[model samples]
Target: MKIVQISDTHLTAHGGRTQENFERVVDHVNNHLRPDLVVHSGDIVIIHPDDAADRAHARTLMAEFTAPVLVVPGNHDIGEPGAAPWAGIGVTDERVAAFESVWGTGHWRHDAGGWTVLGLNSELFGSGLGREAEQWAWIENTVADLPATARVIVFLHKPIWQVADEPTDHNLDIGESRARLLDLLGTVSLAAVGSGHLHCYRQTRRGETLEVWAPATAFVAGDGDTFAGPLHQLGIVEYDCADGTVRAGYRSVPGLDDVSATGVPEVIAAITALTDSPVG
Candidate 1:
């Protein structure tokens, strides 16, 4: 199956150049790449997590695509688990409901192209919410019932690992749920884990699974200390899976300014500070 992955569009209700950039991306996907499926890793909207207008606008934009699109929730769309609120915004039942009311569900499972593709809400990883347990149970049951030969691929907003083996307290990683999730995956024929939260594009292989980090179509993170991979670029990741092999590639959006050159040091600083803050 041909799949195109785009993340962190960060669209706002008022609309701006970023929205235009997203339009260009949809056009490119429809006209040039023409993938079989489009998956958005997360962060479909910007700033507030419960803005109905922003959510509506984002939904409208996503509808422009010709291919089927599946999405998981990012911290921007639904607040991070155990983290302090950003400007009084945090994940709540209402926020979760609002997200689901528009985007269907935060988790999904599909059997296609000789693979079982699963998407989960990373915000619930360590949230301590009732839904978290429910999601975990669902994942366990879903994976447990799959055949031993089934090829599996998982998608989420935050990654399970950032550096090699060291674990950080950052909310962007899966935190306390990492061990359990990894153990669960150990039982399956895992193919790839695709995610987007770092606002950069990176591909790493951990044993047989491909770890893909799709770049944000909106803007790349500017902080150098926290983000070690390529930054300040806007793009998408394309993956082709057939039989049992997966091939992936990155395509940068043309005519877009990198975050560093956009002269938004204060915006970048705010994001970096918010993400770096300790979980409350």
Candidate 2:
């Protein structure tokens, strides 16, 4: 199957430069790429996880795509997860429920073409909530029982690692659950893992798995990078999976302006108003 992976659209009904760029992404996917499926690696809305209008606008914008879309929840969609989540916007059950009410299940599995594709809710990784435990249990049981010959691919909002010792909260490594999740995945016939949160694009090879970071369809983090890392321009990732192998590539579409979160004044103002933290 041909799949296009888009991430971090950061939609907001209020003042949405992100949504304007995202509509270009939608147009590109519809008229040019024309993939069989489009998987969004999350951050579907900008800050303010409680904003229903943002989520509704996101849903409406995504409807422009020609193919079916699947999504995983990013920190912006369901709040951050650690004990010291950014600006104290930690993930909660109510926030998760609200995310699901619009985006459907943030965790899901689809089987096709000899491959098992899994979408995980990254906001639940270390949230210490009942739903987090439930997701872990499901992952354990499901991952353990995967067909020995089936090629597996996992998609989530947060990555498992980063470049060398450069640490960033943009990944699951910030949580204590990384080792366990990796160990479980290590046992499977993993083919590739895809993620997006850093608002950047990168790739790494771990044993037999290809880890790809799909860049944001929204703005690059730039000066607003609460969690710092490489800042790449906006784009998407494409994957071709067939038989038991997958090929991945980064595609930078046309007409996407390169700017930081400052490009959207409303997003910056929301962060300051809600979290009492200025754009760092």
Candidate 3:
């Protein structure tokens, strides 16, 4: 499937430089990439607890997505800061409610072109709030429904594993629920895992699955810091389940230029390499 992953848009009704850039990114996705399916990892808006106008604008921006956008909630959108003490609480629930009011289930699973797509809510899992059990149950049932020959692709807002020691509390470590998820995934010939909360693109080998950390569409976060301006990027990942091949590439928005000048090509190469390697 030609799947494109974009995240952390940080949109707003009050137009700003970021919103303009987001529009450009949306146009590029619609006009250029024309992906079969689009997934936004989370943080579709700049802030949580938005007013009616803000929510309406967000819905407008999301509507620009030409492909079906399977969305999840981010810390900023959902209001759950896993490590940041000052970050507000109950934001995850409210953000998810808003997302559902506009988009629908912040977490779900479906089948497309012989591949099983699973979308999970990481903010809820990290915040210890909202529909985690229900989502988990749904995931179990959905995976069970897939045929044995189908490839499984898992998408979540927060990554289950980190590429390196670049520690940030935003992503779940190899913890209990994460481990359980991995264990369940192990039963299947998992294709790849995609997540976007960290901003930087990262990849790690876990058993037979390749966990890919997708870069954000709005702003990039450095390996470990929040305040550092990481850069602006929009990314895409294409999966060929018939041959178990995956290809990833992305570009900077507004300008809609590829990031080959930076390290993005190398990231894409790494992701594709995993798809070629025998499942170990």
lDDT of 3 by residue, 5-76 (tens): 877666666655446656787888799778888888776765444444655787788788889878776655
Arranged by lDDT, best first: 2, 1, 3
Q: Which candidate number would show the highest TM-score if scored against the true structure?
A: 2
RMSD of 3: 10.3
lDDT of 1: 0.81
The candidate with the higher lDDT, 2 or 3, is 2
What does the lDDT read for residue 249 in candidate 3? 49
Q: Whole-model lDDT, candidate 2? A: 0.83
What is candidate 2's lDDT per residue for 157-272, written digit by digit as tens? Answer: 98875433655554444356778888988888989999998788877788899999888988886764534444478999999998778899988889898888887876787777
Q: Candidate 1 lDDT, tens digit per residue, 196-272?
A: 98888889898999998888887777564246555447899998998798888898766666664144443444355
Worst 10 residues of 3 by lDDT: 258-267
Task: Give stretches of model 1 more than 4 Å off.
Answer: 83-88, 163-170, 224-226, 260-280
Q: Write the number of the candidate with greater TM-score, choosing between 2 and 3.
A: 2
